[model samples]
Target chain A: MISTKELSRRGFLNMGAAAGAGLVLSQTGLIRPAHAAAPLAPVKAEEALIAFGHTGPTSDEGWTWAHDQGMKAVEAAFPGIKTTYVESIPYSADATRIFRQFVSQGANMVFATSNYGDFLYDVAKRAPKVGFYECDGRNPLDNLGTYYVQHWYPTYVAGIAAGAMSPTGKLGYVASFPVPSVYSGTNAFLMGARTVNPNATLQCISINSWFDPQAATQAGTALLDNGCDVLFGIMDEAGYLQVAQDRGKKAVMWNTDLRRYGPDAYISSIVVNFNDFYVKQVGRRLEGSWTPTYELLPMGGGVDRDAWGATVPAEVAAKADAVRTKMMTEGYSPFVGEIKDAKGNIKVAKGQTMTEQELYHWNWSIEGVSGLDG
Target chain B: MSTWRLQRLPAASPLVSLSARLISVVLALVTAGIILAATGKNPLDLGAQVISSTFGSSFGMADLALLFTPLLYTGLAVAVGLRIGVWNIGAEGQFNLGAFAAAGVALFLPGPPALILPLMAVMGMAAGALWILIPTLARAYADVSELITTLLMNFVAALLVTYVATGPWLDPSGMALATTARLPVEVPAVWDIVHWGLPVGLILAVLLAVAFGFTRWGYEVRIGGSNPGNARYAGMPVRRHLITVMLVSGAIAGLGGMMEVAGTVHRLQGGISNNFGYIGIMVAVLARAAPLGVIFTALLMAVILNGGIILQPQGLTTQTVLAVTGLILFYAAIGDEFARYRLIRNAKPAGTR
Candidate 1:
């Protein structure tokens, strides 16, 4: 209908416009052209496959076990949905391959139970349609989200009980690493303990692992022998708790209620539950309303301190419970300012409350705390 | 009267070794099959899945190559030490130090990648040699057992890596734990996720094979391994050969670690070795310490490792797969023992008759 010269000019203009649009879109972080227009289409429950890559064995009654319970809850919530998991997934190129394998198997959603970082990013970039979730993860792509719990609140509550019960007012904490979680936990615990006993001091030992029972036991022994009457740790198993019981010292633990290992030594645990979170996420994924979200499940929702141990005195439990009730009822956050680092440097100014972001990324050792390096 | 007796041969034929390996692998598979069947799993279906998943796609082959590359270097390292009768069980420590050194250069050095990469390689090799220097000197000078000294260093190296990764080298961006920042330079990927490491490992294996099979140094090392006393009596520098062979052994393993960090992981992290150094010992033993034979043995080990990964979706854990690997190694060891013997028919002595 048109002359050849005119048609060529029109076509050239069209190509230039298209190239410009792509460049602009990519620059603004909208490179996923397919997803930019709409959310992923809903998939049938029977056809949906959810894959999980766990960083540790499910047998460890710790972090991985908590995630495994969430997986089971997803299965129960969506009767027709299929779920599969690979445990002890190492943080290496092997992680990339396993995630890719999940893609090849037509996974509708993939959840890395821990922060896999670039290992998982490599797979998520190529598979835009699949929903991805990473726990304790920092980065989030359009198709990927991150989730973790506000475990510090419960840990602080347990610390109050530890302070009231400790005769020497000295606390020993066995930590995994100098990551944000360890920092926040140690700081929160010491802060709560100082409220009860002004002279209380906490010492932490970093064993450089999330689940090394032998090392944890040795660290606990060293702490107790150093005159610490109460022990606390962020280990998966009841390593330090067993050590405490053997030495007749009180200890608080993480992940699950490991009182069976040392009922006499148990004070409380920062128990974490991911059931409702996983169920809701999977439900959204199925109905096609899924979108990446960075969620920090608050106190008493996905995380809480366990019931008082049989050996815990009523007065100690009452003191800790009063703080727990106030925080839950009035949205009270004990992470107020006037806080100081171990080197006597005032980090948080007086009357200034710390935000969720600051609490989540806490990295320095607080005043009256020692033995953490970053 | 005639009697049949078993006689041990001084050396095993290549054909016998090959057959023994085949028979042992088959026996191991059959044993694994029985165990799977007992556990209510369909072995035949699982086997089909393993084959199809491993060889059916380009990605699978690339994955196999990535796994194969590290084993090749470590296998060659152990085999080289075997030539001089030095048990360099400390290959794991050398590998860690090599990775650490390479990562150090990548992190601190500001030069372009082109110059830095080769420098990283040299630094890696030097670090690996240095890591084993104490054990090597102890063995060559004081007659201390390299086996015990080398093995103990592995724990120290592991602890050191963990400490540095969690402390000084921890990612400043707060995006990762127990690891350094992602390296700026990578061993350029050749296909899919597989990088230049595959070819590098292959070339090293061929070069080592040539050097060990055709060089006078290799012949003297072999003679020294066979009998240090005899070599010394014949005016051979047995101590010099021992020192050089052990150092070269550590260097090869160090190169492996360097390639692993720069090529595959692209970061310095704890537990990066993934037991590759230990598994290389099995590969060397299966290859009868032959440099050229190591290629086939490493590939075989890679296949088994990949097979374990492919079967993960079938409700199999890494521990179960490790057990299967142990079974294969056990059978292969028994086969090696059998390879040294032959059945012979002989007549009774005249006095007995």
Candidate 2:
């Protein structure tokens, strides 16, 4: 299942380049150099239209809900700004069509809350004046920028709390795919846990989707069956947290505060809020100062850990908070080398610290992290 | 007392069928409009917008054409199967394998575009037929229901396509994730965005109409489908005909997939089929499985699908669009049954006579 999901993640990532002549013939233009284009001209707030294409529905109460909250924030900030969104956009030619529809509708700015790859690139290349932002996107064009959260920082903090809370020191992770994001999340988490207990090991089950509550619940059960006391995952729901609550185990979540799902079992979540970011970007677009910018929202800014769950011991919370505060205030990074991969190879030399780029693209598992190697 | 009796006709007239379809669509729309009004949305305004956007601009037309091409292929595929009283529910899987095989040729074969294109087409058709081979065999020999066997292959095909497209065939550029690199060759465009695939599909539909309407093989197949016992008693090779017809049906759907990859998408990716194969079933049924009629039905389906896309920005979810389509199908099916009946007044009381 893990190997198959590793493939599924690939499918999830790249989609739509389907049967159409114009788009294919124009493929050469898709490889445009990443030179910075001039900022778009400003427009009146009331007249300006901003469109968002979300990968999932806003009702998801998780990843997409957070983004919707950000959209709402944009609305509140720029009172007269018109914001429209189409939810659950597939990674297919349909994405290209939706983005094209936005341009045709006179949208001044557009946000695709997922990496749409060529689908977005095709439209961005065609419309040079429209400002576009894709979340977790790699390619940047003159008109297209990309942004994602520095989620690993918060994930590390939650891992610290998990380390102190788990009596057995065995952590289980319900993962979506073996993608870079999952790799970084699992690695940073274990790196934090190992600081508390050197013999700590992490086991992962890739369920092949970013949001499959049933699969996640089963994975959590299997992990518990294997003696994992603390659970962590990069999912868009509280499936595992609910399972942990039922099974009386500790669990860490991602995307918003989900304590209501399982107050006792919930340790903390890698909460992401794009409100300020969206408002600022929209502000920039309205003022004609919007340049395509690559932003990795820092800890405490756009992404952070939620307030500790109710049942979390005060000492454990304080311990994790200290590490969080040090990272935020003193710029301390725990991703320093003396790091070894799962194969026992010294991936990062003892004196060297991994850069943000390296961390963002971490693909391999660290030592003592099993099941993700597939 | 006056009395009337209802009788079902052996066949519904073409005019009756056409009227039934039209009236059903209109009724479905009216029903949807009432629901929308109850929800406080202006259904009339929304309908106008859908019409204007779909017909007003060249872009919308191109979108329709792109959508129409696949339906044409898949529609004809299912229609052909229905002619022989078989249900090729696995057209989705066949379409995927066709695309997969064609993409393999595009990616792996070392040949010029001229030579490779035809090779890809053949490979695609073969793969699609191969995908249905087990189901076809079971139905022909062991009397297993092709509906169940064929339908089950869709999942397997989808998984296999997802596996290869994501694993071994993943684009190395890192620019694209779930798809292979763009194919070096593509089906040339005849219009702005419409490709040669549309023309090819149209031609195939016409050819099938001629063969079925004029040939002895077609007659035998039709007879075999309507009554296997009679055909067998008359010394017709019923099983062989069934096998051939089923394989041909799969090949047609496979060709659609091939065209989609080579002519339209220019890459292989999961969800590439976009439920076109499933939608084809509706198309075939609505057209009464007539090869000539499929062309028109496919267009109608395209209009509805494109309308859904246009209405998306207005906050209509895809699920809602599907519900609306289901309503149309339900009304159409009911209308078909209604068209089959006629009422006649009794001349006199039977006992008195």
Candidate 3:
């Protein structure tokens, strides 16, 4: 019954009034607020609780310690959110129990750092409400996320530095399991050394555990005895560095800074800073928009950076800087170009760049690895 | 030379026994409190948390029951071994072998449910006994210490399980890590919450206890164990008794492994026992090798283990629980020692003066 202009003005005023009422309700805590009103449905108000499971005690003061530090940083960045953790969870049914308990205790997100991925996935299925993130590169499900450092890239870069600095062409790599993650890092080191010194050879050994100082020491001793002048470890334990120091050989470390463990022998180490990725994901989860998918952050994902230990000589700093720059800026992937499996099968051809998904599902061993079944 | 008399030792009074137990429990609590204080925790609060977590809910109670089932078996095994003066540290090895055998039966034998279930359990028990045979023989013939042989056999058994899980027995669709195939759901359920094997394990433990307490063979074994020379003089076959005790102990441990595989995991994984055999030794010692006491001690340990997980979410470490358990064991031992020997002060001052 009203004119067109009057009718339009009245409708606009009514809409404005409704919005005002919503704003008041939201401010007074009477109604739940949306993340963004226009584009996506407003995300629900969620309290993100990130759970980190470690195979060893936090007092191990190396690999688990570094990861715990990063988790602590995430907790600090986000107030009103909690971070729950279970240390020394055995890689068996006990691990499954702990994961189930975490989810039951309102852990919205979980980071399983151990290689027991098979059990983790089953637990994840049982706990659909909780999101799962595995540090190992196993076949992930829709609700399970997998992420790992491009350890090979940094290992090769460090290897080049070790090669150029070494008086002898012999290098030693003390490995944990024969899994693809450790294999890739070992093969990359060999390739990096070969790039610098074409005649260089790498001696590799697997101790079948992620952290066993005694085993690492024995393996390191054997490698050193076998004409390896420089040492490196793809294991979480820093015992290799201690052995290298005792033998007076240059050493490369993984997972944590080995300056304290082997101050004299530590040259450079690859440190995994999972906290950076964890913080961003946790922020989203806190805003109630958590998604379950693989998050493969390249060298930029807070890893692939080297933390030069106190043992690294000042003269090698410039060379290490040059190598790191090349890796970070040039998009130098370890899987690029022709590569062979341990069985002498060609894995990657020249001019080939593996997609992130392929890297995530890598199931083959690299060239020069021995004593591995698969 | 005309007359001689032998005096018999009087029986320990009930009041003394009751006081001894009470004092032991108090001592254990005090020791636990000291350890907690050293670790910067409130002992009372920690104790309460453990109690509440263990018996809080139906799920918690089920977890306790599942934990207790294995402990109960291991406790019974150790108690029987102790009664024969044989330290069977090989219960762990026997249990693992039993689990492996059970897995074989469950996986390979395809038959009607009625036939497969009981058959698998028997096979598991037999496998456990066979595994302990080497240690038993070594102790009997080679004069090797059963303690060392049994303990060493655990490593071999664990590795064997590992090899099978990683290679021949591995699940085809399993991940790169070592593990077995998913078990079938038809494995019987004891309670709606706890697995069915738990009731079986408890029943076996009770039956063994009753047999040990009431039967003539039980009395013979007890008499032989207390004094081998006297038993031999009484015409009891000491060596035969020893072998029978070892076999029974190993068989009981094997049944625990069967329950773990057929009821819970359904696969033989490495380190499945998780030192249950070792804990059984402690339980046996705490119970003074009595069948009834073994039941109670096993339940206490299970409560601690199940509750330990619950306390983890509340920022308490497993070490805290371990410390408390050690304290309890220490107190129990002290109480036992006091029961055997009376403390007396010598009045030498007046004589010296």
When only chain A is evaluated, what TM-score does every model earn?
0.88, 0.89, 0.81
Looking at model 2 chain A, which ten-residue stretch has the lowest summed lDDT?
A: A20-29
The 10-residue segment of model 2 chain B with minimum total lDDT is: B170-179
Reference-based lDDT, residue A231, model 2: 97
Q: What is the interface RMSD of candidate 3, in Å?
A: 11.3
The candidate, 1 or 2, that scores higher on TM-score is: 1
Q: Note the residue pairs that clash in candidate 3.
A: B190-B195, B190-B196
Chain B alone vs. reference chain B, TM-score for every model: 0.97, 0.97, 0.88
What DockQ number belongs to candidate 2? 0.31
- Residue A87 displacement (Å), model 2: 1.2
Indicate whether candidate 1 or candidate 3 has the larger lDDT. 1
Chain B, candidate 3: TM-score: 0.88
Going through the candidates in the order shown, the clash numbers are: 0, 7, 2
Best by TM-score: 1
State in Å the error of residue B301, model 2: 1.5
Go through the candidates in order and give each one's DockQ: 0.43, 0.31, 0.12
What fraction of correct interface contacts does each candidate retain?
A: 0.43, 0.25, 0.19
